[model samples]
Target: MKLVLSPEQRHLREAVRAFLASASPLPKVRDGYDPQVYARLNGELGLSGLIIPEEHSGAGAGMSDLAVALEETGAALLPGPFLATTFAAIALTRVPDKELLTGIAEGRIAATLDGTEVSYDGSAVRGTLAQVLSGMETDVLVAPALTGDGPVMVAVELAGPGVTRTVLETLDITRGQARVVLDGAPARVLGPRPEGGILDRLCVAVAAEQLGVMRASLEAIVGYAKIRVAFGRYIGSYQGVKHKLADMHCKLEQAESIVRYAAWAADESPAELPEAAALAQAYVGRACFEVARDHLLLHGGIGYTWEHDAHLFYKRAKADEVLLGPPRNHRARLAQLLEL
Candidate 1:
């Protein structure tokens, strides 16, 4: 498949890149930027409602467009809860809560999907959902859990009584994650437990973001290699470094192919979506992390220091790889899906 983006999609990516250039440059993230800033921007850009139907106060662009927008955001390392908020928006689309969707589109409310947890009693959830992108400041939490009816997602207000949020000091300072405690908190079940494979859709969306991260990391490293010198010549001139860069480029292209395939499959609901999502996540996760680390090494000691932004992406890549589900989990799923 060519995996060519539509003209509108291309425009969307360019527009988002332009917006981030002016509003959400890397410095903003380095300064411990507030997520509400992007939340408000999302409202203004109508991104919060991109996947929602026009009748529901959304652009109704669908997953592919949203994935393209997120790819640009990841490239810029735009601070805030873009992914988490987007996931929340997806969940809201299934519910009859017009108020919730409108609130999200207008930036009046923040929401996140806690797909990591499987169950929760009133007081606490027994499992750990790590690296919850955009979990820190979201007002609503949508989580899938096992109920008598099967697996279902329930929406809970974070500020409601008996809810506690503890912020985790994470390596990716630009984004935030928090462990939420729900003590008999009131929750509204969004819909019947998803048995027809809704979680697979969510996974593909995450893999799309990983693809963006990998591309950005690859670009950064390649750019740095051309400028940084060793042995009185640019490091990139060395054969050893050239091979590494070649490998990184190849991996990134492979990841791009899989990600685009997964995104397309998600939109069309193809039989290949499950396997594509797994392949994309498994490969992109590891490739992006390795590329980021290699980029750091190319920067020599400077990349290792906090002053340099390389480590920021390095950490984000690692965290994102393991966030929704690690490569190992995805690979296992692929094996099962392929009956291998």
Candidate 2:
């Protein structure tokens, strides 16, 4: 299939790329996502409204359009509450919650998922999520919980009491995670879990990011290999090095195909989105980590140093691998989808 992004989509991707390159360069990204920077990205750039409907004052973009934006963010290593808020929008837009949807479109709320062990006892919600993505500065929390019937999603406004958020010391500090403690917190049930295939759409979003990481790291490694000299010859001139680079390039292309297909399926083919997402994550998750690892290895000793950008990509790749679920988990899901 010939998969080409529309000019408008390409423009959006380029704009985000330029914005992140100048605004949130690799050196400035540290400790955690900058709140001021996030404000500019969402409010000024209108990125938060990309997927929300026009009635909600959003761009009314499709998943394919959102995926392009996500790819650019991943390449730039732009850290913030973008992912969490997008997930929140994905769920809220499915229901008739115009207020929350409008707020999301206008970039008023920062949200993240509390994947901690949430359990509902008919009357109250209780759980302690150890690692919430971008949870420190979140205004709302979209959490999945186990119920008597099955699983359900709840929206808890963090401005209220009964919810405690403790920032965690995570591996990738650029996009910080937090420990969220909910003790009988009052929450609004957004809808049934997986409403409008939010999880699958989310998986596609992240997989698109992994594709960006793969491509970015591959380009970086190849560029370095071309310039770095050893034994009076460029490192890339060596057969072994060239072979590894080729393998990485092949995997990156394979991942791009799956990522694009998954994004398209998110909007056009709901019935196929789950399998598409699972396949993309299963392959791209491992591929991203491997590509970053190889990028580091090919860079030699400096790659292991903290000052190197390779390490940053490496950490993000690792984080993306398990952000939704690890490669193994996605692979298992894929098998289940295939009915194998």
Candidate 3:
């Protein structure tokens, strides 16, 4: 199987990178979510529908294409519901909800899904989800809820009655998180339960995002090292600093390799996807966080300051490390999957 991104994928990367450079600069990330910017990203670029089927008014692309775009978004730290929307879209595809998928593709609907302990009794769900990605303003929430028969996937409308949402202050302010409490909220049963592949795909997507953060962190520190001098010599010229930067570069390389493999597996080899996704999260999650931490430290005191972008990268790295249940969790899952 081809491990490298195709030419079209490369062009997609360039286009996404260019758009983010102009539209999602570092300064804009601090401004929080902007509907207009997201509209352009979704409407003009068609990124929101990149992985959706054409019949659903989407781009009908695959996971690899989505990975390329996600890498660029992560690098730019583009603030919006893209990640949440992507997760929602992927989950819905299993049951193929025409209206939901079409609305998501059109940028009129936003969604998120993380399995919860809510109780589902026939037509509705009731319980509290402590934290949900983009739940504060999301239009729909797709999650697995417990029932007498078994766990089932349910979709709830946040705008409808019997739902309360409270935004939580997250370390990475660029990505919003919320607490959702549902009191017999009306919901539609999407399927019996979320598919195993769905989780694998989500893991792959997150690994790709972490890959971007790693690359950007390494680049930022390398650029800073080239010019910053101390003791009458470029800081990068110092053997100690060189070692750290070299380690970070190596980590980034390993992460990129794993992420690419996982993304390919998701699209081309369903049988291999579970193992590949586990490995990607197990390795990339920790590596990205470490690289970000080192990147911050190598920048000296300025890196920790609020004024510098270094802190933002560091925070995102940390947030993403735990976004999908930490590296250790994935490692355990990987070990189980491999029977090792």
Which of the two candidates, 1 or 3, achieves a greater TM-score against the reference?
Answer: 3
Clashing pairs in 1: 122-183, 122-184, 151-193
Best by lDDT: 3
Which 10 successive residues of model 2 have the least lDDT summed?
114-123
Tell me how far the alpha carbon of residue 103 in candidate 2 is from the true structure, in angstroms, after superposition: 1.7
As for TM-score, the candidate ahead, 2 or 3, is: 3
User: Could you estimate the TM-score for every candidate?
Assistant: 0.91, 0.93, 0.97
Cα lDDT, model 3, residue 317: 89
> Which regions of candidate 3 fall more than 4 Å away from where they truly are?
none
Q: Write the per-residue lDDT of candidate 3 for residues 77-178, one digit (tens) a residue.
A: 888789999998888877688888999999988888877768988988899999899887688998888889998888899989989999899999899999
lDDT of each: 0.76, 0.84, 0.89
Q: Which rank order by TM-score, best down to worst?
A: 3, 2, 1
Candidate 1 RMSD to the real structure = 2.7
Tens-place lDDT digits, model 1, residues 7-76:
9999988888887878777777787656656665675577777887777677878778888887877777
